[model samples]
Target chain A: MIRVNNITKTFAEREIFSNVSFSIPDAKIYALVADNGVGKTTLLRTIANIYNADSGNVVSSAKVSYLPEERGLPLEQKVFDFLLFVAQLRGMRKKIAKTRITDLLKKYSLFEFADFYIGNLSKGMQQKIQFLSVIIDNPKVLILDEPFSGIDEKNKELFWEELLELKNNGASILISAHKTDDLTHFCDAFLLFDGKSIEMVDSLQLQVEQK
Target chain B: MINSIRIIWLVAKNEMKQMFRQRLFVFLLFILTICAISDPGKENLYFMFFVLNFSMALFRSIASEKESRLAEYYISIFSPTKLLLGKIKAYAIFFFVISLLINICAVAGLLRFVDVSFLPCVSMLCGWQVFVQLLGCVFYLSLVAFGASYSRVHTEMQGSIFVIAILMVSSYFVVENLADIFGNVLLCETLLKYIPFTMPFVKGVGILPMCVSFVAIIFILKFSGKIYKKRLFYYGKNKITEG
Candidate 1:
């Protein structure tokens, strides 16, 4: 569903990573594990077309929903307003967006928090809101950076459940997480991210190309 | 594009919330009205000038979020052109409401004190002022949006370069007024021709200036859209996005 070749990103004359290349298989959970500034988010940006590749190309057949590790949620935002905005952006109508947001809120036990300002909630809760903002749309591909950081264990578990359900429902997932141990269970394969090199990581065969 | 529009509206609606969340909007209107009404005779024009400066300062606050990473979340997703348009739309509505209130106040205050003939000046003055301010907002935010998109540090301050630029561009207008004291209307006319800001305004009985403003908006919109398209590194100065 996605192919990236020799994608290089630099900031301030310093190279973040170079010659990064990979292809995400259809309907599989692809985990891109790396330390901060190792070009994980930059790589995702390239795939999402937020940042262009310096010397390579990323070809993707699926629409992508990108979730950055940062606190992307506006704290003063209302849950309904926030989710509805995201849903509508993915091309949902206002009424459909409203209905979808209501269902997601209730399903996630966020019904009571729907009207609460994001800033008034705990950081974990706010993170969930941010996640919902992206996931509510159900894009063909999900690219997440640090998807499990900063949330409560319960919320984290809920995220895993939701992710597995998404995967089962034919959505390809690519994620970067701090906890490499928990990833072995669901993530079919990963990209090894060191400071200068992003290696294709698999007990199975992996493709490599340089731009 | 629908996605872009929805996202822009969300961000803009939130921006409006932020505007109202702070008491500054109401405070500015209140202070301006009080100043206009309390003025004594022709001295009110002096107060009116102060109101202009105050409004400029108030409107500049709209760019504050872009200066900070506060707007970054949405910035990462939407096209820069749409983002700029949405923010400007919200600010336009804000300025329109404020302009309406200020116009009403100015007309009432002027009728109560200055020559009642000043009533005719209301529509013209307010129209010109609103147009000029809108021009300033567009010009300033276009650059600020660039700074936010590209600059690595202290973008808030970097965004002010646009505001300072407006000041510099309009500085020639000031010179024309001062030169008139010496009955140097010819020199003022000649100087105004070469000056960038004055040139646009007087090229054809305000038509040139209006056309220039509209053209400038299209230019900025086109440029920002190009950045959204072919440009890899936006925050045009920021290399972070350079692949």
Candidate 2:
């Protein structure tokens, strides 16, 4: 379980969010919905420990994998090299990282481009690579920010399938996006951000509202 | 400690490979080779050439990461100390290689003009050249890294360049007229001794200055690491706390 207690954040004297408290239970998908510039990314980053909250604290007992909205990978590295490096950074052994990366590449049909530099790959392919890095280690807490931004329909399905599989395996998944419709089927609950704070809404109610 | 070393080594290797791939590095290196061959006997010119080239190299190595926002990813994974150490180690290796090549060329040129009997002196001179260049590289690189850490994309490159220029000019002026400025104050003399690359050439390189340079390098590295951590991890309108 992950508990966020009264987390507050501000940038340049402007408050992004304040007194934001929530809990993420195991084996559940929490959809974070907010408009652009409304602190969706900031909230995810805070939970991932990338950004520190001003007045609150977060407690978690699980391994975390965060995919930020911005893809800041080294473009000079080859696709395989980048994935392997990220795996190692996340504490995976060299032999395991290499084997898992190879399998991931083959599974995602990226095997042919393993040796190709990431800068040469398409935007969608790069996004997929980033997504793969997050799930490669089967982290207990998966925080994905705008995971479907540049992905195509087919790749989006692949991502959803993998996310659901991870969720079924008891991963606490917090995914944020502009469009909530795509996540209606997978998310267990919806956390609505109204610029100042967040409120939890039942997934059933969110589905009915969408209807 | 072992884990940190491994992380540093990995980061350094990757950084070195990425640096070597850049066309700018290759171009500058070729130009520096020509300059080294042409001005082998002119110590000041050679030193200036190294200062400028290595300063630019260190600046680009760091500033480019900030420009591309890649530092964010690495900072999230590794501690600031590890990241800084990795970069310093990588650049140290780079400086060592370049210095070795230039020393070889310079020594060859000297041998052509001088006699074979001065071989031992030539060897010692080459070794001293590596030490001086490495010390200079680390000092400038640390200063530039500290500067680059706090700056964003547009300003980081220019900021590092400005810092290197200012330090190079100010250190030269201060070292040249140390006695005139401070008038034999023991404390001032003691402090000046620790400034790397500031000592005058005597019969040979002084042991005291070499030890001082090593200590100075450590101090600069520690100071830079602190700055990097504060800049990278704790940047917001409010105080950031770790859980």
Candidate 3:
């Protein structure tokens, strides 16, 4: 479980957000819905500890993984090697990391291209690798910012299946994406950012309101 | 403590693996090897080349990571201190090997002029040179890392690299003439030997510079680690000014 207590953030003498608080319970996915230039990415980054809040704190002992909105990948690195290093950095043993990476690649049908440099892959494939790196460790708290911006529908479906699997295993996910139709199906709740704060709304209630 | 060390090692190993494949780095190594082998009597010039080459490589590595925003990802996932240490560790190992090779080449060049019986003395001298060069390289690289962290763009870092190179050359000149200014050769030598930039050019092995270099490394890493933590997430807007 992730508990965020009245987190406030400011930058460059401007308030990005103030007094925002929410908690993500285990075994569920939450969609962060907000228009561009809003505090969606900033809020996610704060929760991931990439950016510190001006006040309050995030309390979670569970292992967390983050996928930034921008593609934060080393183009020079091969897919398998990159994922293996990330796994090891996350404190997994090398042998286990290697095996886990191999299994993931096979499952994703990327085994043949595991040795290819990430720069050589298509945009969708590269984004797929970025997502794979995040989920490789089965993080208890997964935070994603605009994770599905430029991918095709097919890959998006594949990602949703994997995210559901992770959720079933008791991981809490906070994902912000442009595609609400895709997220509305499986995401257990929606955290709507209104440029100043976040309001948590149930998925069923959100669906009824959308109707 | 053990886990921290392990994290550093893992980062270092990964960095080394990736760097080996960089075409620019391979080209730099080729040029360095040629310079080391071709220049015989100019050890000071060779040391400058060493500084320029390694510092550029280090700067390029840091700059590219920043440009690509990969540094942000690494910082988000792992502590910046461990990541920086790991990067420095890898560069230190690379610098040590290259310095050793350069010293070996210099000693080999001396083979043509020195007496055959003095080969053992030359080898011992070469060993001392390698030790001193390693220390000097680490010192300069740490400074380079510090400068690279604060630079907001590629041109800015390029300017910083040139400034650092000049500072290195100036250190050699200062250390060489300090005795004349002080009118006491022994005292000057004792004090000036602690200057890491002078370590590679010194004729004999001295312990002062080694101690000084270790302290400088620790202090600089601490200072730079703080800068890195602050600057790692800063995605500043780049704008051109009107003339």
**lDDT per model, in order?**
0.62, 0.75, 0.81
Each prediction's TM-score versus the true structure: 0.76, 0.81, 0.89
Stretch of 10 with least lDDT, candidate 1 chain A: A202-211
Collision pairs in model 2: none
True contacts kept of each: 0.19, 0.22, 0.46
lDDT of 1 by residue, A40-68 (tens): 77677677777666788877776677786
Considering summed lDDT, which 10 consecutive residues are worst modelled in model 3 chain A?
A177-186
Candidate 3 lDDT, tens digit per residue, B1-243? 988898899999987987798788778777877876787656666777766777887788888888888887787788766776788788778877876777787777787988889889888877887777777777888888888786777777888888888889887776666666668767767666777666655666477668888898878877887776666555354542211
Off by over 4 Å in 3: A178-180, B34-42, B102-128, B176-183, B196-209, B233-243
Question: How would the candidate models be sorted by TM-score, starting from the highest?
Answer: 3, 2, 1
In the order shown, the candidates' DockQ scores are: 0.28, 0.26, 0.46
Model 1 whole-model lDDT (C-alpha atoms): 0.62
The C-alpha stretches of model 2 lying farther than 4 A from their native spots are A208-211, B30-48, B100-129, B153-156, B169-191, B196-243
Give the Å shift of residue A171 in candidate 2: 2.2
What are the per-model numbers of colliding residue pairs?
4, 0, 0
